[model samples]
Target: MKGRESGMPEEDYWQSFFDADGVVETLFDAAGVAGDLVEFGCGYGTFTLPAARCTRGVVTALDIEPLMVARVRQKAEAQALHNVRAEIRDFVSQGTGLVSATQSHAMIFNLLHLEQPLALLREAHRTLHCGGTVAVMHWRSDVPTPRGPSLDIRPRPEQCQAWLYAVGFTDIRQVDVQAFSPYHFALLATR
Candidate 1:
């Protein structure tokens, strides 16, 4: 199924909003993101390529848009990031198509505003190995941002925390991402 539109900006404009490398580095370090990682909505591979570099195991990047998936794959190949596996998949409805308890970490950036966030969080919980972590990032609703979904639809950190708890995630804590992604907030939960 096609996911709800996120009001994603143009590629270059979207890219300008983030320091992908710094955000990835800070979040991964805090979450101890290692081993195989699963990224939801790998738009432009902004985080995917950097994530692949951080882990020895594969980075499985799934997106509903074929163009986004293709772009990610192209970038991965150009960077010779052999560990990246970019594929077009409706992960929200079909799940990640990964073996249970196989992934060490999961990335769900700028996506919780979707209609069924708990479903996606459940899938992330299902894919993670015991003690594995899931990182969630969303545009800050408190401040006006250059781009992002409408503030009315954006989920707050507290709301996201509740959803994570509902999906059987533990050790939920906020990670400060202001230095790298000033317009966003992040949370890390363990499964």
Candidate 2:
């Protein structure tokens, strides 16, 4: 149950397209996220490392790609970040394997464009504690991005909000992340 291909460029090339610090900062700020966090599709540890450093609790990063998981684990180890748990997991099929009502926040970065977006959003809702946050980001449909899924499949912010609402999330608000990456937009939803 691996997600659809991200259509990303090489690691360095894809990483070069984003201001990682700015994106991570804006995401956490918009979500009011703290405590334990779960990140889905943490490719190349772009956001995972910063999140591990920022949170007092653990940051569990899950990816279907073993290479991606290993890269994140390597970065966490190099940084001596004991709070990170980078595991190769097909959460899309097996679920998060995290206890319900346990995680304070869930991150679905660059992944909502998958074939089963609602299913993933439902999983995010289930994993979070009451009043917990669900942060989602995708390539902005309005602009041409250096690399991302086709525009026909890329979700708009409003569509994401509607899906979150359908999954029992509330307080859904758009976060202005254009400063971080002009091609991306983000939203924060509460469960």
Candidate 3:
């Protein structure tokens, strides 16, 4: 199923809001994002290519939109990034088709405002091995952002942490991503 509308801006406009490579480096370095990684909503391959460069293992990038999946695939091919696997799938409704406990890290960036936040977290939990990390990022509600979901639906950092904890994630700590994405807050949790 499609997720709740995030008020996503046009691709270029949305892309302008983040320094994708820098944000990826910061979050991945802190979370030890190695081995195979799974990215939820790999829109425009913004983070997928950067992540592929970081890990030796495959980067499984899933998105519900076929255009997004195709875009990621094209970019990966153009860059000769043989490690990326871009697929069109509704990961929110159907869990990621990865073997349980097989992923080293999962990226749930800017997607927590969905209808079932816990369900998504649980899926991430189910797919990750023990000690595997999940990185969560979302727009900060306190600040007026250029783009994001409605303020009422936007989750606070504490709420995201609580959901992570509820799904059995540990070592949950906020990471400073303001340098790259000043409008967003990031959290890293271990499964």
lDDT of 1 at 154: 87
In what order do the candidates fall by lDDT, top score first? 3, 1, 2
In every candidate, how many clashes are there?
0, 0, 0
Off by over 4 Å in 1: none
Question: lDDT (CA) for every model shown?
Answer: 0.90, 0.87, 0.91
lDDT of 2 by residue, 98-177 (tens): 99999999988899988999999889888999989998988887766778887888889999999999999999988888
Q: Please identify which of the two predictions, 2 or 3, would achieve the higher TM-score against the true structure.
A: 3
Q: In model 3, how large is the Cα lDDT of residue 19?
A: 95
Among residues 3 or more apart in sequence or in different chains, the pairs in candidate 1 whose N, CA or C atoms overlap within 3 Å are none
Over 4 Å off, model 2: none
For model 1 the TM-score comes to 0.97
Query: Please, what is the TM-score per model?
Result: 0.97, 0.96, 0.97
lDDT of 1 by residue, 71-106 (tens): 999999988999999999998778999999999999
- Which of the two, 2 or 3, has more lDDT? 3
**lDDT of model 2 at position 30:** 71
